[model samples]
Target: MIKTIIFDFGNVFINLDINGALQHVRDTFKIDTLSDEMTAFNSLYEQGLISTDEFLEFYTENFPKLSKEELVDVWSFMLKDFPEHRLRFLKQLKSTSKYKLILLSNTNELHITWIKKHIPFYSDFKNCFDAFYLSHEINLVKPNPNIYKFVLNQNTLTANECLFIDDNADNIDTAKSLGIKTWRIDIESEDVTNLFNVKTNLF
Candidate 1:
């Protein structure tokens, strides 16, 4: 029996144009792909090992032609619309009080800042979860077994009793390896609002 539900914040909730964002950045920077150093910097930033000021400074120094605001805009372009029906579903689920709800996401500061500014019901969405863990805030990220261990340990939750839902295959694999049930949502044909119907076997 699944007593807890852990959800990914990106494609599972808010829409993300990951490929589109990467293409936009490549075109803006006139680079075919992100360099190793840039990738490392992003990982460090997501792990909260670096401050937001330091992150912005690195980008500003590398691309002197681009302002901090422009860089933020490009970085945050991956975040798309968050449907209200998802919030409604979450609210209804919370109201049931039948299971522990946790939100686990690998997100950075700029992306969250953009979300808070653009999403009118951010607080309502957040309140639906009993625990909310963001990578930068928690200094841990998905696909890392330690992060899952931390959540289980923190909540005294047995992995077998928790269902982890994410859009990332790697993340799902890690959770499954940890003995947690998982749903790798297909964003193209699946909507989170249909969770009960889609995951009927689990329920």
Candidate 2:
């Protein structure tokens, strides 16, 4: 019956250029790709295994040439802008009271802090969700079965009764494996502006 709608926050709400961040760092720092250590540390960073200060320190110490601000800039480059129309759509959906709306995002503390600072209506958008789960805060990131299981357990939602929407195909596949219905949306084609079409009874 789809009693709940679990949404991925990145492309679903705010625009994120995942490639942009990598490119930004590569070009600016003269680096070809992420280092093996950085790649390994990222998993821990995303899961909140390390504190924010520890993350910033790791980069700052390794790249002495790059200033703290510049490191933050490259790290934060994936974030672009949040459109106004999407916020309105969420507001409309919240008013409907048809389904339990939850946001599950694989994001870190620094990016989240940046979002709140940049987006004027950040609080309003968050208010629309029945639950807003962040990977760093929850110590669980998506594409892992445990994170999906955590949400299901926390909300007491059965897999069959929830629909998961994510821009990442891997994340969608993981959700589907757990018996949840999923929409692996293309960020370009899927305008969440027409969310009502995807959902029924959201009056």
Candidate 3:
């Protein structure tokens, strides 16, 4: 039986235009591809290996033409609206207390700041989870087995008892390898509100 429900933050909750953001950056930088160093730095930032100021400094130095504000805007362009129905689904789920709710996301500080500013019900949504693990804050990002081990160990949960829901195939594969059940969400055509209906076998 699944005693816990783990959720991913992006696409699963707030909408994100990841490809659009990448294209925007490519246009802004006049480059077709991101340098390996830039990609590595982004991963480091997500893992909280570097401070936000340091991260920003690297970008500002690399792209001297863009101002700090413009840089921030470019960085946050992927984030879009959080639909109310998802929150309602989460709240209703939480009210049951039938399962432990966990939110695991590979998110950075700047993105979170933007979310808090724009997603008014952020706090309420957070409170619905029994445990909330943000990658930057925890110094651990998903698709990594350590993060999953950490979540399970911290919550004293067995992998089989948890159902991790994420939009990323890599993330879901990692969880499945560890014996955790998962729902690889289809953001383009599915809504989390239909969780029980869609995954009736699990329920």
Give lDDT tens digits, candidate 3, residues 45-161: 999999989999999999999988898999999999999999999999999889999999999999999999999999999999999999999999989999999999999999998
Candidate 1, 1-203: lDDT as tens digits? 99999999999899999999999999999999999999999999999999999999999999999999999999998999999999999999999999999999999998899999999999999999999999999999889999999999999999999999999999999999999999999999998888889899986
lDDT of the structure predicted as candidate 2? 0.89
Identify the superior model by TM-score, candidate 2 or candidate 3. Answer: 3
**Native-referenced Cα lDDT, model 3:** 0.95
Model 3, poorest ten-residue lDDT window? 194-203
Per-residue lDDT of 50 in model 3: 99
- RMSD for all candidates, in order, please: 0.6, 2.0, 0.6
RMSD of 1: 0.6
Question: Can you list the residue pairs that collide in candidate 2?
Answer: none
Candidate 1 error regions (>4 Å): none
Give the range where candidate 1 is weakest over 10 consecutive residues by summed lDDT.
Answer: 194-203
Question: How many angstroms is residue 51 displaced in model 2 relative to the true structure, after the best TM-score fit?
Answer: 1.0
Pairs of colliding residues, candidate 3: none
Model 2 lDDT per residue over 8-98, tens place? 9899889999887888888987889989999978888989999878888898898888888888888899999999999998899789898
